[model samples]
Target: MDNPGSQEVDRIERQESRAQDLHLDRVVATQPEIGPTPPDGGYGWLIVVSASIYHITVPSLLTLYGLVILRAIRDEEHEEEESLKIWDMDLALVPIIMLVIRLLLESWCRAVVKIFNMPRFMALAGLCLTVAGVLLSSYSTDTYSNDHIVNVFAGIFAGTGCALTGQQTDVIITHYFREKLTIAQRLVRMAPSIGNFLAPILIGYLCTVYTGDVIVMIYAAILMQNCLFLASYTRPIYIEKVIRTTYNMLRDAADDDDEVIYSNPNQPTPAPTTQNPQQGTSQDDDNDVVVFNSRKNAREILDPAVQYRERSEPVNNQARFSSDFSAMFAETSSNRFSSNFGSLDVINYTSTSRYQELESIDRDSQNPQPLYRETTVNAPQNNIVFATEPTAGTIRRTATLKKNLITIANMLMDINFYLYALLHLSTTFSILVLGVFFPAYVWLQVPSQTIWWVATTIAMGHGAALCFLMMCLVLPQNINEKTRLCAAFCFVGALGFYGITISGNRSFLILWCMCASFSTAASSILQQPLYNSTLNEFDTTATITTTNAIVAAFVLTWALLKNYEYSTCFLTAAILQAITAVIFFALSFRRRR
Candidate 1:
C-alpha cells in the first residue's frame, strides 16, 4: 500500500475482480438512473419489535387458544338453536373469510404506499384502525349471519396496521444500519417466538382462574390496549444526514492526474501530479482537493465533491489524524477530506437485512454489457427474506403481455394460490358429509382397528412432516429457520398422539393431519429457499405457484373427491407424494445449475 494520500486510482480493477467471489456478486442489482433510499433508523426497530409482539399475542388467540373468551351471547343469541348448530359449517368460515378479506385489503393498502411516504401518519392510521376493529368485534356478538362480515372488518384493521407499520419500519432500518442486516432481521423475525412463548401460558392461567365473563373481557381488553399503546413506540424512520452524488467530480479529479508517455524510443517524462485514489479512496492535484476521513462513519463521511467545494478550516490534523467529521457536511461545496484517506473509488456501499444492496462491479468488468447490476433491500422480516432485485450477468426478459390478455388470464389463474385453501376446505367437508365413517367402522373391529388406525395415521403424519420440512429448507426466501424448525418439531411430536377411527371403529384421520403437516415442514422449509434462488434465475414468473397448483389440484381432487375413505386415501396420497417429490427434486436443483 502506498501513502494514504498517494494510493493508485487503478486499484479499483483489482477490487472488481474480488467482488465476484462475494455472495453479493452473484445477484444483479436493478439500478434506476437515480436511486432512492428508504426512511431508515430512529424508531424503525421499535416498530418491528412492536409488530412482532402484536403478531405473536393477537394472532395466537383463536377459539383454539382461548386468549379471549366469548360472552354467553350463545344463551341469548337469537338466530340459532343448538350450540352445536351455532358452531356449524356456515359459522366456521367467519375467521377464514376474515383472513382472506384482510389479505385482499392489505394488498390494496400496499398499492397505495407510493402515495403515502409519511411513516408517522401511516403508523397512527394503523393503530387507530386496530383499536377500532377490536372494539367493533367486541360489540358484534351475534351481529350477522355471515360470520365473514364481522371477521373481515377485524382482520382488515390488523392486517393493514401490520402492512403499513412494516413499510415504515423497513425504510427506517435501511436509513440507519445498512451493515448489520442479517442480525437485525433475525431479531425482527424473533418477535413471534418471543411473544408466543409466554402468551399461551399466561392467557391459559388467566382463563382458568377468572371464570367471570366481565373479568375475562377486562383482561383481554387490557392486553390489547397495552399492545395498542406500545405500538406508538414503533415510531417513524428518519435519516437526518444525507450524502449527495459526487462520483462524477471524484472521477474527474482522478482523471486530472499527471500523464507521462514513453514514445519514439525514449522521451523525457513529466513527473506525476499524484497517483489517483483506488476503489474506496481519493487524491488530488493543484486544482483538485482530496478528502480522506477514515475514522468517520459512512453517513458522516464527507463526499469527495463536498470536500473539494468547502472552504479551508484553520485547524491542523494530528499525526495520528483527526478531523471535524461532524462539521464536514459540505454537500457539493469544495472541502478537503482533512483526515487520513486511502483507495480509488468511494464505494458508497449501502446495506440492508442480510445482503449488501448494490451492483457488482465485477460482473460489469467481465461483460461490459449495457445492463447494470442492481439490488434492492427490503428491510423487513417475512416468511421469505431475500433481496428482491435480480442478480448481475442476468438477461432480464420480462414477458410483455397484452393488457387485455393478462386481465383475462389473471381471472382464470386463481387455481395456483387458491388450490391449497380449497383442499383444506374440501378435506373438512368430505369428513363431515361422510358422517363420521371411521369410529363406526372400527366399532365393529374393536381393539385391532384402533392400533392399525393409530399406526398408519402416525406414519402418514411423520412422512408429511418430513416432506414439509424439506420443502421449507429448499424455499429460498430465507424465512426464519428457527420458527420453521420449531413448527416441524411440533408436528413430529404430535405423531405420538393416538386417535380412534371417526366411526369409533378407528380410522386414521388424526394421524393423517399430523403426518401431512410434518412432511410439509420439509417441503415448506425448502420451499422459500427454492423459490428465492429460482427467483434470482426466473425473475417473478409463475414457476412455483404453477407447479404447486398443478400438483396440488391432482392430489387434492383425488384425495377429497374420493371422500377421504381411509381404504384408498393413503394410496392416493402416497402416489401424489412420489410424483411431486420427483418433480420438486428436479426443480430444486435448477438453481444450483
Candidate 2:
C-alpha cells in the first residue's frame, strides 16, 4: 500500500506534468509558421540573371541624362532670360524630383510588396510605368513651356518605376541566394558598371545618328525586354510551414511553477505542439498518446518518444516533433535536437529551484522513465490544422507590425547608422551633381573638337573602373577595410573635381573623369556589404529612402542658392566629398579606439 506522503508527492507530480502540457499547447497554438530553408542555389541563378538585367537597364537610365536627355532639353531652351532661369531650375529640380519620388515609393515598399505578393509582378508594373514616362517625355517639344512640366511628371513616373523595380529585384535576389550571396551580389553590382560604361557610348552614338525622341523610344523598347526575362524565371523555392514556439515564455512559466526545465541557451528554440482535435484524442481524454499531421507529410507523427527511439534514422525520415522532450533530456544532448525545436529539457519537478544543474539529473541514469509513451497509429491524410479563431490571427499580425515599427525606430536612433547614411548620401550627392553638370561644363569650357574625345575617355574610365572593382571583389579583404578604401577613393575623386575647377585642359579633365568614375564604381560595389556588416537589422528599403530624402534636401538647397556656375558646382561637389571623407575617417578612428 502507498504511504500518504508518497501519494501526495505523486499527485503533485501529476499536477505539474499537466500544467507543463497545457503551457506547451497554449504556446504552440499561438505560434506563427516558419518558412522552409533556402535552397541557396538551384533556380536562384536564373533570378540573378533577371536581376542583372534590371540593374543594367533601370539604373543606367540616369547616366543617359547627362549624355542624351539633358542635352535634348537644353537644345529646346529659348533665348529669354526667364527661360534660362526655368531651364536651370529644371536641371537642378528634375533629378531631385525624380529622387524624391523614388524615395517615397521605396519607403513604402513593404506595403507595395504585400499588395503585389511577388517581386516579379512589381517589376512588371514598374516596367509599364517607366515606358509610359519615356513616351510622355518624348511627346513634348518645348523645354520652357510644356516639356518642363511634362519632364517633372516623366521624372515622377520613371522614379516610381525604378524604385519599384530596383527594390523588388534586391528582395528576389536576396531571397534566392544565401551561400553564394557574395558572388551573386558582385555579379549584380558589375551590371550597373557595365551599363554605365556601355550606355554613354551607345547613347552618344545614337544621338549622332537618331533624333532625341527616336533615341528615347529606342531605349524604351530596350527596357521592355526585361518583361520577357522576368517572366522566364520560375517562382521562388517552396517553403514548408512549421510552427514557431516562444521558448523563453515557457521557461519563465516553468520557473514560476517551481519546476526545473533544462535548455541550452545557445540552441535554437524548438516549435511546440498543439492539441490536434482531429487526429488525436480530445483534451478531456486521459489517453497518454497524441498524434498530429505535419503539413509536409500527412503520415508523420509528432511524438517525442517515437522520435528518440528512431534517433538513428535519417533526419528526413524522422518524425518532426513539436518539441523533442525525450531527446532534450537524453544523456548527451546534441545539436540535432536543437535544430528543429529550440533546445528544451523535460521538466524536473523534484527540485524547488527554478533551474537545477544538468549533473543533478542522476535519476535518469539510475532509474529512467519516459516522460510520455508513444502509440503509433496510422494518421489520416488531412491538412495541418491551425487555430480557426479570427482573434489569434489579428493579434499575431498586430504583434508583427509593432515589432517591425520598433526595429525601424531603433535603427533610426543609432548614431552609427545615421552617420553611415550621411556618408553614403554625401557621396551620392557629389556624384549626381557632377554627372548632371559635367557635360554642360565640357561643352562650354573645352574646345568643340575635344568633346567627343572627352566622352570616349569617360566611357573608357567607367569600363576600367568596372574591371578594377570586379578584381577587388575577388580579393580577400574584409568589408571594413574595403569601406575605408572606398572612402579614401572618394577623397581622391574630390581632388579630381578640384583639378577640374582649376584647369580646362582636356588631358587633365580626362584624368579627373577616370578618378571620379573609379570612386563611383567602388562606392556602388561596397555599399551593400558595408550596410550588411554595420547594421544588419536596418531594412534596405528604408536606407535607400532615407538617404535619397537627405540627398533631395541637399539638391533643393543647391537649387535655392542658384549656383549653376560650372566652377562653383564643381567646387561645391569637391567640398562635400572632402567633408564626407573626413567624417568617415574620424568615425573609423573612434571605433578602433
Candidate 3:
C-alpha cells in the first residue's frame, strides 16, 4: 500500500515506533494530551496558578533598575582605576564581559528548550556553566576582569534559568489557557513589584545595619536559593499525549504494504497472506480499548475554543463517555481498514490533521531542522492549522493591530507602566525638593553615595528583564507573540533613565521622564494592535520584532548618547519619547491606502 489514498481494502498491517521518556508510565496511564478542550478535574489551572506564584516576583526587578541607580555609580567611578571602572556601576557593578556572558547564556537556554528531549541534560549543563562562572569570579579582588566572577555562577546560571524557565512557564500555562495569554502576562508582570518594592528599602536598612558587602552577598545568595525552590515547581505537562499522537500517525503510515503476495510455482509452498492479529499482538495493552481510546479521545475531543463545555446543567458524564465511545469506534475502523499509508485515522480532522502536520515538528525534534535556519522558527501543527480559523473563542487571533487581544494586553499592561512611572515621579519630586532647595527635606535621606547602587540596580533590572522577554519571544511557536512581548519588554529598558531624572530634579530630567513615557506608550499603541490584527504568527513575529527592535532601539540609543547624566539624560529621553509618541500617533491616525 505505497502511499495508498482513497483505497478500499482490509486487514491492515501497521506498526509504529515510540521512544524513551521519564514519564512513559504516566503517558500510558493518563489521557494527558487531552486536546484543546479543557480537561476534567482541571488541574492545569492549578499548575498555572502555581507557576504564576513564582513568575510574579521576576518582572519588576528586571525592568526598572537603572532608572534610580545609574547616575551616581558612573560619576563616582569616573576617575577610578581601569579595573574599578570595567563595569558600569549602575548595571549592578557587573562588568562589561558579564553582560556578554549573559547574552550568550540567554541564547543557549533557548537552544536547549527547542531541543525538548534534551531539557534535563541541557539544563544541568547550563547550571554547571553558570555556577562555574560564579565560582571563578570569587577570586576577583577588583572590577576589571570581574566577569570571571560572573561567568558561570550568577550570570550564566541565572541567565539560563531565566530563559528556560520563563518560556516554559508561558508554554505550560498556555497549554491550559492559550486563550488567556495576554491576561496572564499582565498579572505575571506585577510579580516583581510585589517582591521588590521593599527590597531596596531592605537593602538600605541592611547596609545601614551591617555596613558591608559581605552580609549583602550572603542574604542575596539565600534569596537566590529560595527562588530555585520555587523553580522546582515548573515542569513539562501533557508530553505523553504528544508522543502518543505521533505514534498512531506513524502506525497508520506503516499499514501501506504489498496487497498481492508473489506466487512462486516452482517453490515447495505458498505462504498465507493474512496473519492472525491475536497471535502477533504484544503482551502490552494493545488489545485494551480504553488504552487506545484515551489517545484517540484527546485527538477527538471537540476544542472548547469552538465548542465550550455545556454550562446550563452539570456536564453529563455519560454523554461525554458516549461521545468518546463513538469517536474511538470510528478511529478503530479507520485503522483496522487501512491498506495504505495515506489512510488517515483522524476521525473528524483527517484533512487538517495531515496537511497541518506537514510542517508541524517541534522546534526540538531531532530529525527536522528549522525552516528559518538563522532564526529558530517553529512550524505549525496539524490541529492548529485547522483550528486557526476565526471563531468567537479565537476571534482575538484575527483582530487588526488595534483590535487584537495583544493590543488589549498591551493596554492592560499600561496599568502597571503608568503606575510605576507615577510612583517614581512622586519619589523624584520629593527628592528634588530636598536636593535643590532645602537640606531639611525628609526624602533627601536617600543619600548621594548610594545613588550608584540605585542606578546600577535599575540597569541590571532592565537588562535581566529585557533578556528574559527577548528569549521567550524568539524561542517558540507563532514567533509573533514572542516578538510583540519582546518589544514590550524592551520598552522599559529604552526609557529607564528618564525616571531617574524625574526623581532627581536635574535640569532636563522632568522633560525626559515625560517624553520617555510617551514614546513607550506610542510604541505599544501602534505595534501591539498590528500584532493583534494579524493572522500569521510568523509574519507578525517577524515584522513586529524587526520593526519594534529597530524603532525602539534607535530612539533609546539616541537618548542615551545625548545625556549620560542623571538629570539631562532623562530629560532628553522624555523629549524623545514624547516625539516618538507623536510620530506614532500621527502614523496610527493616517489613512492607509
- The most accurate candidate by TM-score is 2
Best model per lDDT: 2
lDDT of each: 0.38, 0.63, 0.37
TM-score of each: 0.42, 0.63, 0.44
Candidate 2 global TM-score: 0.63
Query: Which of the two candidates, 2 or 3, achieves a greater lDDT against the reference?
Result: 2
Q: Tens digit of lDDT per residue, candidate 1, span 158-259? A: 545555554444444444444444334444433333333344344434444553233335534644554453445422222221112245556777766343
Order of models, best TM-score first:
2, 3, 1
Q: Which candidate model has the greater TM-score, 2 or 3?
A: 2
The sequence of per-residue lDDT tens digits that candidate 2 reaches over residues 459-488 is: 776776676666756744355564466569
Once fitted onto the true fold, the runs of candidate 2 whose alpha carbons sit more than 4 angstroms away are 1-35, 73-86, 89-93, 140-146, 240-413, 450-454, 537-545, 560-563
**Candidate 3: segments with Cα more than 4 A from true spot:** 1-35, 38-42, 45-111, 117-160, 210-216, 219-223, 226-238, 248-530, 534-563, 591-593
Model 2 scores worst on lDDT over the 10 consecutive residues at 371-380
Candidate 3 lDDT over 1-593, as tens digits, reads: 55454232322322112232333432333344434332322555555554555543332222212221223233345443222211233233222233333333444444455567443344334444433433343333233433434433454444454555554554455545544554445445434433333444444344444422332344435334434433343333455556676788879877654222232233333334445677573222211222223322333323222234332323333343232333333432222223343434444343533244435466448686543332222323332222233577566545554455555455344332332222222222222211221111111223444543443342333234333333332233334333234333334424543455335443233233323323233233233333444323333333333332343344334423432333343344444444433333434434422
